[model samples]
Target chain A: MGRVVVEVMPKPEILDPQGKAVVGALPRLGFTQFTSVRQGKRFELEVDGPVTPEVLAAAEEAAVKVLSNPVIEDVVRVADIEADAAATITSEGLA
Target chain B: MGRVVVEVMPKPEILDPQGKAVVGALPRLGFTQFTSVRQGKRFELEVDGPVTPEVLAAAEEAAVKVLSNPVIEDVVRVADIEADAAATITSEGLA
Candidate 1:
């Protein structure tokens, strides 16, 4: 199986009030060195086969269409990881 | 100021108990297709200047050293962002 890592972030030039609030809350959360917080989500899916480029692209498109808000969100990064080496190496070689 | 985005993930080889639990909970959480969850953390820093390669590398190192568990955690990815064009372009050129 392969895993896709999607990184969702606020668009540049926009102010992140939630991020600011989280940053402000850090010191109280027992982290004195915590200067800021960038809120995002992490998801792992057990898809069939290895991390083919097509699979990675599809997952990311799915993430954007279903999981994220386009207006506020910036680009979503897709990292495809295959659990099994034999399939993964073959997929990578094809790519 | 620039924003540094840090992504932390569990080690690939290790079994993720939390991930399993989260995956089990997804259907109940209104996600019929939601298969799994790999938890991670995100941090944003208001660094001076643009996204120089050195700064991004340093942030990743700091994240590994201070914020993550070496035994269980795998790798930390750092992305540096500069607000102003004047600084970021120069830094990118340098990299």
Candidate 2:
């Protein structure tokens, strides 16, 4: 099985009420270091076969067309889960 | 300024109606490669100063205590955005 991860975030200009609420609540919860918060969406899409480049391309297309509202949100990241794991491992080695 | 990214996902055993709906809709939208879909949450927390270890630690704590509900969600990742960018750059080099 292969999985792709897609992340979508609201446009910076848009007002994010949920984020505002979170930032407001954090201070009360004693996590005062945070100055702002922006809530977004993450999606994991699974396929039966390996995540080929074609699959990733399709996932990216779908991420923009279906998963997010273009007017208000931006597709921030789209990556293969296995590839991401490999990247993390390589990065850890470098670190 | 600094930022931390936190990702939360539904527990494996939990029923995800939104995911189900997405999976059902994918075929209709001509995205037939996907077999399953799971939706989750992503949060970006900003701070006035650089993202220190203490800030990242606080973000992790907040992710568990406030960003996600223990009953149904899991805090999958919490990382400083700048660090993540560095990791990505290193990973790309290896790739």
Candidate 3:
């Protein structure tokens, strides 16, 4: 199976109450280095075969049209999961 | 300023009703290639200076301790936003 990852974030001008809440809470939790926080959404989509360009195109279209609200959010990324390996931490390692 | 991006996902064994709803809705929206979908959270933490190793480490700690629930979610990634430039689509480009 192949997987595509999509990331969406709120527009810079938008007010993110959730992020504000997190930033407010972090200092109390002793993580005081962060000055601000912005919360967003990540999605993983699975397909039966390799992630072809056609699949990526479809995913991108879906990301913009269905996965995010253009008025408030931006489709920041749409890519094959393999391309994200360097950044992804497997749950086993954390376990 | 520097930004750290953190991604958190629902554990594979966990029931992701939001993902299921998306997967079900996709076909209706004419996106049929995807077989499954998993929804997750992405956070961007901002700091006043360049992202040092110490900042990255702190973000990772916050990702696990405050951003994610170990029982149902996995802290999949915690990286400098610069490292994500290749995948990130600036809103201006989309516009």
Candidate 4:
């Protein structure tokens, strides 16, 4: 099977209370260098086989239509994680 | 400024009802090739300087202690997004 990952983030103009709360809590917990925090959703879809372009396209469509409320959010990234092994090996040179 | 992204996902044994709902809805919505879905949280932190190792470590600690319920979920990925530009250039070669 393959995995398609989608990241759904709130629109820049939207007020993310959860993010604000986290940001507020950070300083109290001694993480003072941080400036802002934005919280979002990630969905990992497992398909029956290697993730193809069609699977990505459909997943993107699903992310936009059902995974997030488009009026206030954005689907920022859609990645075919099945290809990650090659990319990781190229970047980290891990065998 | 720089950004650090933390991905929090449910443990393998945990039942993700929200993900299940999405998987169930996909077929009804005409996306049948997908077999499973796992939902998670993504946190984007905007820091005051370049995302250094210290910042990443603190963010990782925060992710483990506050961002996710350790008893139920896992912090799967902690990324220095400031370094993404270099990686993207290497991979996609976008100027």
How many clashes does the backbone of model 3 have? Answer: 0
**Model 3 chain A worst lDDT window (10 residues):** A86-95
Model 2 per-residue lDDT tens digits across residues B27-72: 9999999999999999999999888878878998999999999999
Order by TM-score, highest first: 2, 3, 4, 1
Candidate whose DockQ is highest = 2
DockQ of each: 0.16, 0.60, 0.40, 0.51
Kindly give the stretch of ten consecutive residues in candidate 4 chain A with the minimal lDDT sum.
A86-95
Candidate 1 C-alpha lDDT tens digits along B11-81 = 87778786787567646544444455676655566555655556555566656765567888855455543
* Residue range A1-95, candidate 4, lDDT tens digits: 88988889999999999999999999898888789999999999998877777887898899998899999999977777645424433533311
Per model, the share of native interface contacts recovered reads: 0.22, 0.63, 0.60, 0.61
Q: How displaced is residue A31 in candidate 4, in Å? A: 1.3
Error of 3 at B16 (Å): 0.3
lDDT of 2 by residue, A16-81 (tens): 999999999999999999999999999999999888888888999999889999999999878877
Residue B21, candidate 4: Cα error in Å is 1.0
Q: Would you estimate the TM-scores of all the predictions?
A: 0.51, 0.93, 0.91, 0.89
Docking class of 3: acceptable
Better of 2 and 4 by DockQ: 2
The worst-scoring run of ten residues by lDDT in candidate 3 chain B lies at B86-95
In model 1, state the lDDT of residue B50.
Answer: 54
Q: Interface RMSD, candidate 3?
A: 6.7
Regions of model 1 farther than 4 Å from truth: A8-39, A50-95, B13-15, B28-36, B81-95
In model 3, the clashing pairs are none
